[model samples]
Target: MNSTKGSMINEKKGRIGCVKWHGDLMDTRTFSNAGQDLYVRVNETILAQYAKSSGSLTKKAKLAISIVSVLLFFLVVFLVYWLAKRKSKGKERPDKFVSRVLTGSTYFEKSTADLDDENTINSSELPFFNLSTIYVATNNFSASNKLGTGGFGSVYKGVFSNGKEIAVKRLSKHSGQGIEEFKNEVVLIAKLQHRNLVRILGCCVQDEEKMLIYEYVPNKSLDYFIFNETNRALLDWTRRIFRGDQNEANTNRVVGTYGYMSPEYAMEGLFSVKSDVYSFGILLLEIISGRKNTGYYNETYPDSNLVGHVWNLWGEDNALKIVDSSLVDSFHFNQVARCIQIALLCVQEDPTERPTMSAVLVMLSNDAALPQPGKPPFLVKKSGTIEDNSINYVTCTIVSTR
Candidate 1:
């Protein structure tokens, strides 16, 4: 081949090399690090050329061989250089502005020690998890790790190097929340301070990947047992709390609302984690203030149920008024305030917004940020308008009784 022809081929090879280099970085499903292994072949190829005798070769033939070999040598050398750089980068961690997304298919240990010195998080600011760390924690977000799927995304179970459990909420590509909106939500969620609410441990937003990290609620979201014959028998609302396992017996009776019954159970014979959360919320409020919700009616707030009265007080910044007067002087106001906010969260009208029993436990244990509670269910006012809440009812009755 002539020099012009040979040069064109090399140029073409260089362009191909460039594509392979960056293409792997951008779309990694097919990425493979075999460059180092191929580097030694260059030496072998060069040495083999000498073994071919030049006794029968003319001067022009010799020149052509040398030119071709030189071009090939440069091309491989440039490839090696590019590959080496990329290979080294595998060990590096991404910056605030992430650029790559990697996928791995390996996991057996519940969790392993693989991360950037503990997510490189400030430990005080909004935590940012490396995509790699999240993958390891959730076993690459395995299907088995999935707890449930919601409108916004899917939730998966995870564990850390210390065997600490966590929940990962991976948002879908079409979730409609862009990077900016997600960032804003993260910031707002971080500012909240409570235990019952979902605690944000960290988050990952790399390239097209977006996920939120939370402490795993082992017992699970809400109580689905008040309906189960066995569970219903095992627990009474007065003693047993919401543990969303399954079922509720006695489909033949009207177990009237104790004010602790969630709306869904009351109206639709439906129950879920959130529905039970509503029931728990009422119990929580009653316990904190030493007030009985079943017959709660104050002259100052005659038109409101216990849930609404507290919500109104909360809006008026006077929720502490609902605290048990007997213990007010002996308790920490901040702690009590946090509990009130958490109770409100549990009692939220929308079952979807209510925290699960596991979340309630987290709220009681961790110092996670708390969101402002919305109006509770069955909120009534002097104007005669009523705002209903998600409910699941449980009454003092029997499985075969009417």
Candidate 2:
């Protein structure tokens, strides 16, 4: 009974004890009190043999587990690297997009990364106009159909078989503005719904052909009438005289037409909504007086520009003297005088003195006291040349990567 109690105590303590059956001997393994192996068998000789053989077997099993763990760790790392590489390799390049546009596909299919169901089409919308259609429309770009040239390229008028009038400004092969202007006009005009500005209907970029399509203004640009004496007379309310200057390089120094450029813009290249205001001022004066801002000449008043001359007349309260005699017959003196004041204010040398388009529109629509304008720019000298007042003519060019 005492041995049975000792064995029960050893079992509870997890001491290894062997149960020897009649045929096969089964060993029950447990830890010793000191945490060493506790082996119990029939004899000491059996225990010694078992301990020696199990040592090498246990070491081999541990080695197999370590090898499997290392292999699994390496396999996981390799899979992660391969997945990252695949993701990076799938990224689309800009050149690839350009090539796609050049391929002449009728329908443009956007990449999954480029668009989705909630896709908002900005200027970068796929499926642009076909090059073949534009070529056929322009009569293979005949010289006779050419209208006017610009910084980017030449404008050609095209009449489609359906009698659709279209003007295509084909981008020059060497033009720097083609890509950027294409994107800018597309994005800007798409969102801006304005009446005064020329409307851009659509654009096309196919096989290196970048073109902008605008709603054709039948009267053409304001320059057509403002620059020529005969043409100026046409706009002078009936039959009256009007007069213009600038070189090509100086012309392109600023955006917009030559005679139409504000003195501030022509000299300083300072542009804003006010810049357009300055242009509109020049146009207004040309329309009223039938005289060009850049072309007026008089020996008596060597410093007489259209703006300066108008300012003198306004001060004398004889501003009506400058108004074309033909317009005098049918024109409202009150409206004409107010328009002259507004034009003079717009042409002021100081940009801060000019009003925004909204403000200008308001002032024109209502009777409001305008602030006195500062000195107008391009104060004409003895010669009919425009003088630049600003220092840095070449401003930094903004480039878009995408």
Candidate 3:
């Protein structure tokens, strides 16, 4: 019985050993699978992190490029502006340069007797009048002989020794025009020989004295008759008689009559033939309304100047109401209306919009359709200051009536 019991114990031990070996094999297989799964997960995580890093780098590079492009654009703009301003400053005025040349030479300082020599002064183009002759003719510039005054100087009625009627323009000592402007005027007027333009007879440039001799017109300037209440009646005849009629003087100084000056000339010191057209338009309006542009104040429309007042009246189809009261039944309505339209076209703020003188003459004579005018430069009065918003700061010179 002891032998049988020992054999059963051995058998039980063998079974236990077999069970332990099987269990060890199962654990080894599970551990190998778990390790493989862990490696796969780590690889996936590394790839994702790498992709994220690459995307962030691309965004940063794009942002940096955008900032650089913006900076370059502003830099180019600033450089261009600075260069243009420098160029403008470098340009010198022609008149100023001419003045320097004249004053720097001793030839201009010669006496009248020396200047009379044929080789001394160029008298072939324009007649050079003797200072003594002009003095006697103008009665030594007597105030009684004074016909009018202009931005240049005073005009005096002079009768030459030969009984020729002439008008003398005496340059003021403090006149805005320098010697160069005087020379320019002489040269410009000499070349032009239009009947409408004042004819130049001679000139005198002796020492500090400078004068111009012109053919005398029996009637005074158009302003004299047009501005006067009673004298305005004669304009109908005057207009019939003279339907056809006719500068950056210096950059350092502005040379023009106030109120009559064009916006380009008054504000930017720029002038052209178009500037003359602007003046003519203002004159036409003055003739039609019989009121000065500088001093016409309406109690009903206190804020409105002559241009603004006329524009308002024109827009409302009440243009005829702005006409001079003196006309009564004498003036033709169609003619007066046409004149107003032409005048408005001439006073356009943009110089290019204003018609040329030749074009103006055609408009006056013909019945061609006219373009509608845009808003004119309405002079605004602010805090005891006149603000012309269309332009930068300007210097104006008040001129005496001629």
Candidate 4:
């Protein structure tokens, strides 16, 4: 009988635990629904006593507790905000990440759709370089050390005391470019370890001087070769033709020249990874023909640019006629034909039809069957003047004529 009574008391205690406060302070109600009703009854007495004590606490003490809780909440919020801001500010530019993606310096999205927020970069390790160090490296911008000029500014060759050769691209004050492009190039190229593309070592932003430092190419650009007859022979025997395709080889072997600029880049400047593919095609043609694209030839092929001449020879089933005489005996006819076809494909008027760099690599590497190229634009001879209808800077307007 005593054990039964103890069980009854325990059951009663559990029933009182279910009650919950509801409604406003002055008009509160207790909820008691189903299983929850059991606890409300079991814990009622204990809860009433606790409530009585809680109701009598001094308002000042209650206010103090509230203030402390609010302070604690804000402190946590502030800390999180501060940390996030610092992290975002710490992120590096996107170009570096692009380079990393390209060169396999880092493995990431294989396609455009795969890019996600998580693959962000941390900021540059060196925020900025001292102007004095840059001046010392460039020999205070000596004329003899000058490399070349671009839209952004003049590039100068620099050699550090440690035997590191560098190209310093110094931006002009009123140049149309911005810090963003420089940062983009730096972050992109630094991570990209491609043998074909140039490498960016570092950058310097001091007062008015915004300079980008790159690894020096001893022979400089491809323009040095394809633009003149004397220099064009360096590409003789089509050694440069084969050399340009080794995008995965030594960094020094990559070709970049002026007359060798791909039709897409020269016409539209709509560059992608394939822009280099197009460039390689032009360079290959220049090597084989020993001719420059922009140079004036006879009127029969007055529209006869280098690419057009090669195309004409290919159509007549006499592609060998275009090959330089210097390598007539040793040059592989099959290899030369395939290269010319690939070059023509790269210079196609329609950008959409152009093969990607990876595709070009495959075509060059294997015995894969290549596609027939469409007739290129500027195929016909024009009388008198030729107009460049390219877009203008700042306004970005395209000038069209009848």
The global C-alpha lDDT for each of the candidates, from Candidate 1 onward, is: 0.57, 0.57, 0.62, 0.57
For model 4, the local distance difference test gives: 0.57
Q: Where is model 3 poorest over a 10-residue stretch in terms of lDDT?
A: 1-10
Strongest candidate by lDDT = 3
**Model 1 C-alpha lDDT per residue in residues 1-402, reported as the tens digit of each score:** 001111111122344221112111232132274321111112344455644544446666888999999999999999999999989776544333332221121111222233345763443244567778888888988999988864346779998776778877777777643444344345444433244344556667665687777666564322323323344344433222222321121121223344556777666777666865675677567656655565455677787777878888898898889865445445677778888999999988778888878878899787789988876777763243222433232222111101
Clashing pairs in 3: none
Q: Mark the regions of model 3 whose C-alpha exceeds 4 Å error after superposition.
A: 1-122, 174-184, 187-193, 237-255, 381-402
* TM-score on alpha carbons, each prediction: 0.34, 0.54, 0.60, 0.55
lDDT (Cα, tens digit) per residue for candidate 3, span 69-169: 99999999999999998896666334333344344332222133322243123443445677777888889888999987655677799887666788887
User: Which numbered prediction scores highest in TM-score against the true structure?
Assistant: 3
Worst 10 residues of 4 by lDDT: 393-402
Query: Worst 10-residue stretch by lDDT in candidate 2?
Result: 393-402
For model 2, what is the alpha-carbon lDDT of residue 129?
A: 44
Clashes of each: 25, 4, 0, 25
Candidate 4 residues lying further than 4 Å off, grouped into runs, are: 1-127, 173-196, 242-276, 325-330, 366-369, 378-402
Give the Å error, residue 332, model 2: 3.0
